[model samples]
Target: MKHLFGNRVIRLLLGNDLLDNIAIWIRNIAVLFLVMDKTGDDPVAVSLITVAEYAPIFLFSMIGGTLADRWEPRRTMMAGGLLSAASVAAIALAVRYGAWETVFLATAVSAIVSQFSQPSSFVIIKRHLKEEQIAAATGLGQSMAAIFLIAGPVIGTAVYARLGIEASLLLVAALFLASTLLVFWLPRVPRETDAERSGGLWSDMREGVRFVLRDARLKTLLLLFALLGIGTGLIQPLDIFIVTDRLALDKEQVQWFYLVSGVGLLGGGVLAAVTAGKTRPNGHWLVAGGLGFLAVSIVVEAWSVWVPVTLVSRFLVGIAMAFMQTALSAMMIRMIDEAYVGRINGTLAPIMTGTLLAGSALAGPLLKATSLLAVFALAAGIVAVAAFCALRLKDRPSAVEAADRA
Candidate 1:
């Protein structure tokens, strides 16, 4: 544990993830608030903002994953970092020009850049670390990002209050630049071998998909993750509307709800870091996390139906979310073969993108048709399905170290 925490490469990687995460937190909250303020529309409009943001991940994530396999991981990551920085800068410039709609467009462009960044980052870790260290590294990386996720909203809120959302955008852009710099210091990682390569781009993607489908473990993991995404997607939009309408809360107060959840996220990360060295009870944790998330959804979205309860629900959901994400990513890193690791991961991106879109799209119709409680109940049921999917995974001993790449 000491060695894991103290490694220089670990420090570098964690630092980069942390800054990028802070930027993400700021960017997410800022965009939603900015849209609501400018448009004065309902929660549906805010959700649409997210849809635009994630649409590219659906389109290009597999391509990004294939590229990660074909190229040096460090170089891929560096390029991603640079693209993210440039996109962030573009948003800042748009804000400076008072081009609000253009800012949304730039935000979407930034998301597309992230489609390139994340798959590369995941593959880099998969290529570099030992299998034993992979969980610890993944946990620690997520933990660092969680820390930023925990803190960034509060900081962004303060920045938003003092200097407006544009100022927050500028700060986020700066963080991306810092992340790019950290990428510069990261160790180089090799590309996948000829055996891993497919005939052409489309063919390569097809091969990756075929590989994932053939692997029962990979298929199960993707199913669980997709279900999890769908369950949460239902709840996320409700949280905003609950705060805005049901609770009749102001923007500042809503930011506090985000802050509370961030704290829970941090706590979950601590737990993951502490448990990293132990044999993972992967199926158990998945079920527990999913159930916990379901419980939170019920409490906030269904039963209590109040602001404080919603905030607490967000926190509890964050806790469950942290465990699920850390465990699942580590599990995937262990289960997949080196050759198809990038592609296998890439395959999940579209699933996530689809689920996110579903969540955003459903928020509107559901809110219009029924009560918020019904929407929340729907989330809980979806999450239960995710947990059930996890039960189907075949538990296996952790694999060989994830260190060497082709």
Candidate 2:
């Protein structure tokens, strides 16, 4: 922990991540509520906010990632931050003029910029951190995200309730600007060589796809990602129902589940960070174990009608998710070549997003057609398959070392 914090690069990156995530949560929650209030609680209007936030992942992630591979990582991230701040500023102005609809643009633009910035962040981590430090760094980074996942909603809602949408937008913009300034403090690194950047954009993208397909480890990881996405998505939109229907409780009581899960995630992330060194070499085992636990937890959670049992299951699920995510991230950084980091992220992210979206789209209809128990069973089944895949993954030489050997 001391060594992790001592690294200036990691410290700066973590700070930037902290601010960025807080701002994102504030923006997302504030916008959703504002839209809800404006549209008289119209479901379609609320859903469009989600579409604006996520559609950019499908459209710009690949392009943004390819660009990150070509551009200087620090500069690319800084640019993304600046662009996000500027977009929010514009949105604030539009809102002041009674153009509340334009608020969606704030979420859309930031999400688009994030597609580029996020890969650049991974590139920087791969370049700057030692292999041994990667796991701790990844764990720490995820821990910050976990913290925000718990606190962000409350903070966003508080800000919106006290200060109104315009002030909340300003606050979000300021957070982005502050994060950009933090990026400015990051050490500048050399850009990719001309030889490395020789391919056309499409060619580079194709190569990235080919690279993942060729690497057995990466191919397996992609499959794992897809399965996890499907499982998580299937249950994500139904948690409220679990409270109201399954537990025979008030819908408002669902917050307890979130709180319990968040606390578990926070603890799990810290555990992952502290044990990262011991666990790094056997990341696949860690991932598998986490997923295996999650599979069981999901089954228990879905099957239980008792509130205490359900909450405990959800808490364990959060812990399992944190461990799995930390292991997966560290393994990717250690296994992939830095040159392909951005493109690989771009390629793999959409698979999960696509699967998640597909599962989410089908979730309601599936529930109406079948039953909650059936949906949860299917989700658990999918995640169990992913765990099995994880068990088959064998640690090998990093991509750079393999290329050199060839």
Q: Show the lowest summed lDDT stretch of 10 residues, model 2.
A: 396-405
Provide the RMSD of all predictions against the true structure, rounded to 1 decimal: 4.4, 1.7
Winner by lDDT:
2
* Candidate 2: segments with Cα more than 4 A from true spot: 193-196, 398-401, 404-406
Candidate number achieving the greatest TM-score relative to the actual structure? 2
TM-scores, all models, native as reference: 0.80, 0.96
Q: Give the C-alpha miss distance for residue 337 in model 2, angstroms.
A: 0.8
lDDT tens digits by residue: candidate 2, 298-371: 99999999989999999898988887777777787778877788898999889889999988988999999999
The global Cα lDDT (0 to 1) of model 2 is 0.88
lDDT by residue (tens digit), candidate 1, 226-300? 877887777776666667776777756767777777777776666666675475555455545555565555556
Q: What is the alpha-carbon lDDT for the whole of candidate 1?
A: 0.72
